[model samples]
Target: MVSSAAQTPSSSVEQARQEGALQTALALNRLLNPFKIEVKVLGSTAHLRGEVENEVERQLAERVALATRGIETVQNDLKVNAELIEQPLERRAYAQRLEDATLASIIRARLLWSTHTQAASIEVDSREGVVTLRGQVSSAEAKELAGVLASSTEGVYLVNNLISLSAADMARLREEHQELIADPPLSDAWINDKVQTSFLYSRNLDGPNIKVATQDGVVRLSGEVVSSEQKTIAVEVARQIRGVRGVDADMLKVATKVSG
Candidate 1:
């Protein structure tokens, strides 16, 4: 009879390495060719590390990792390298491109949660403008909203959605999200809400000047935190909120006016 005990991680790790090199090779191909990035795959996780020309390349790397067979998740450590730009003007242009991508993602996320729309349940995470979506929605319509919102964002490089829904539902959700983007709402109260809450509750950060505002579910945290660790904690707090889809931490920084 087979034993009920769980296999040790070490044993599992060895098993994966011994299984075949095909998995590793395929992973490399996907990262280098289509995504144009270097990847290191071990067991079920893929580490995407290296410098990319812009945010788009950074996100493409993550998507390729997810598509590769047997990959459970991707650890994205891709950096945006302006130095890769051959010309000085090109480097500035690349920075602008990344900035646009980030801002777009923020706007889209805010629009998504601005109303009591059918997509109230989704969660969005935007980092340097790339959107990573997570959480459960009651229907496919909600899932599509998650994607559409991410896509519509100005600075968005890619949308990484981990939503669960039936095939039929997924189609409906996508359509709805698209419609909202095409005719976005004037006010984004929901997005502001998500941003505010993230800073207020994040354990990874603390600060005195911290001010949080949320519209719909996106949060904007502005203020002063003494240390980088505090800033991180503030962001984490926003992430924990249920309906939050995005967080803007630009306002968080070390206070210069205060005396030590």
Candidate 2:
């Protein structure tokens, strides 16, 4: 025997709770999160009000509301506006970040592979196509070479070379070089990575279009270049890498032009 007056307040509280739950569900949905949606609940029926990118999103919002624990029905009052949606800016930002990381890796590999800068310690950072080089090098020549290699990389727009000459670092590097000379030959994996990176750092070469594979101390190049000179440069770059016994470019070919 509950009084109607008492039942009114209890019913209102239940409606509010249901509305909150439904709104939370909509907000957490990937398709609906980007839109501003409003939810209202009356008894077991939930009403959605807002604009969505398309009919799919409208239906999705209604479906989400209906799936809530206390909602048995949905009143989808959402309007569709194709103009409400735009390309996600975060995706472009993520792509830029990935490019910067790859640029940094290529610069580091170039420094390590160069005979003049091989023993030098350097740090590379890239952002929006600008590269920054830091750490200590044995000579001004080494510092300048590091900058040149970074600036010459395909994706680099500018280089900030902050490498300083250090006598103590030079001594340490010389010792490390001697130890490296006593060690075994560079692994095939190392040679493969360096050769690919070198291509990226070298001008007039299409690094991404070229394929490189290493076995023992030999590198095999296979891919298309715009010209025969590019093909020759590809072979020379691979042969210059330390511990590379030979380069086989039999599969490398120059791209043929079609008449327009």
Candidate 3:
């Protein structure tokens, strides 16, 4: 029989969600929430405490905790039940497996550090030496290389590559990028606007600040040219054939007179 707490509340759905989580947590055993794990319920805010077997489990616990009716926020205090200092020698074995999988997925063919390349994008999950790779890659070479790199790493018994090509296929990926200049959809414009805003706000230069403008499809950059490097970068990036158009830089006037 369902408890009274599980019964549908006359309140809003959000309130129901908060109530549901608290009821569920109370029903579960201490091993589930543990002593270190503290759960706080403040209207819609949910705070979580304690640790779990792995990150996946930690996240799962958070989801369960949030199911309660009034939870607004969740603060996770769940530590990864590391095998080193804790009990149950079996946990140590499991930790080693996870560590190995993380290492294998991040290792490149010849790169020394796992972080040097874009390994963070790749998700690694493993049971023993079996590793599962989930993500997208642009090239067949990249796909094949991903597996080989994972297999070559120590402790990886097998690799399951779940990579799929993005919408931009290999043959036209480079060329298709150029079309952003001719007719941009709203999404493209929003992205460009964000980039331009960030660039303008950055404090990396000192002088008569450069000006950047975009119209219809063309980009016009006007300001005192600081250096050949800056001029080259401005022209190339502002009107890159990929997303933007021809660079109209004639309006730019290099400062020829010093301020008195």
Candidate 4:
């Protein structure tokens, strides 16, 4: 048999490992991750201390802790406060920063994929939904198109276009354009993702209410929109995506308002 001293060290290590696993399980839960919840494990019992939005959430946290493997009992010491439902200011600010970064990336990809603006060297920056475009384009039309694309993207509240017209390298521009043309066709999955992203980013469309599917370069839209004009706009948006051979919006219907 192993000595008691040896067993003590091994047991301690196992307890620490179990503590870390319990903490991770709590953090991964969407409802509990935002709150500052503390977990401590001793033997087979887990201790939880934190503030949750309500009793339901408190129970949820306890259930999650108990469900963890090796955790047989949970000492739930979480307090219920309605105010805890509101996210902390730091969390909100962090989320905004992430949104701005994502918006900038999307606009840059849009410019790169557009045949008219792809050759132009454009820089995109976004802050709190406002986008700033800078760089040089070969012509006035290209510069204007870049600004329009940036403004139309979802989450963009405003656009500041500072692109200037300049004489571009003709040979390099030609080579880039030819490369785009020679590239292989986009896959069906790629087309579907882009189309869905376009709907989500469009300011005038109800993105969540719309469903998009693509097969063989043909896009099929099924969803409800408030007006006929919105339906038409949805079809046009899908058609404009790169590699989309056709858009079929026959199934997309206009929602009739109910009398109050």
For each candidate, give its TM-score against the true structure. 0.28, 0.52, 0.29, 0.61
The whole-model C-alpha lDDT of candidate 1 against the native structure comes to: 0.57
Model 4 misplacement above 4 A: 1-96, 113-115, 138-142, 169-174
* Ranking 1 against 3 by lDDT, winner: 1
RMSD of each: 15.4, 14.6, 14.2, 8.9
Residue range 53-108, candidate 4, lDDT tens digits: 78988999989888888889888999988886566556656656766787899999
Q: For candidate 1, lDDT tens digit of each residue in 20-118?
A: 343344333322332234555565677776677678767876776676667777888988876766534544445455555545445444544333234
Highest-TM-score candidate? 4
Off by over 4 Å in 2: 1-102, 113-118, 139-141, 197-204, 208-216, 248-251, 255-260
Residue 49, candidate 4: C-alpha displacement in angstroms = 7.3
lDDT of each: 0.57, 0.82, 0.52, 0.81
How displaced is residue 169 in candidate 1, in Å? 2.2
Task: Name the runs in model 1 displaced over 4 angstroms.
Answer: 1-163, 186-194, 201-208, 212-221, 229-251, 255-260
lDDT per residue for candidate 2 within 141-216, as digits (tens), equals 7788788778867778899999997779988887877877788898999899989978977876889899999999
Scanning candidate 3 in windows of ten residues, the lowest lDDT window is 109-118
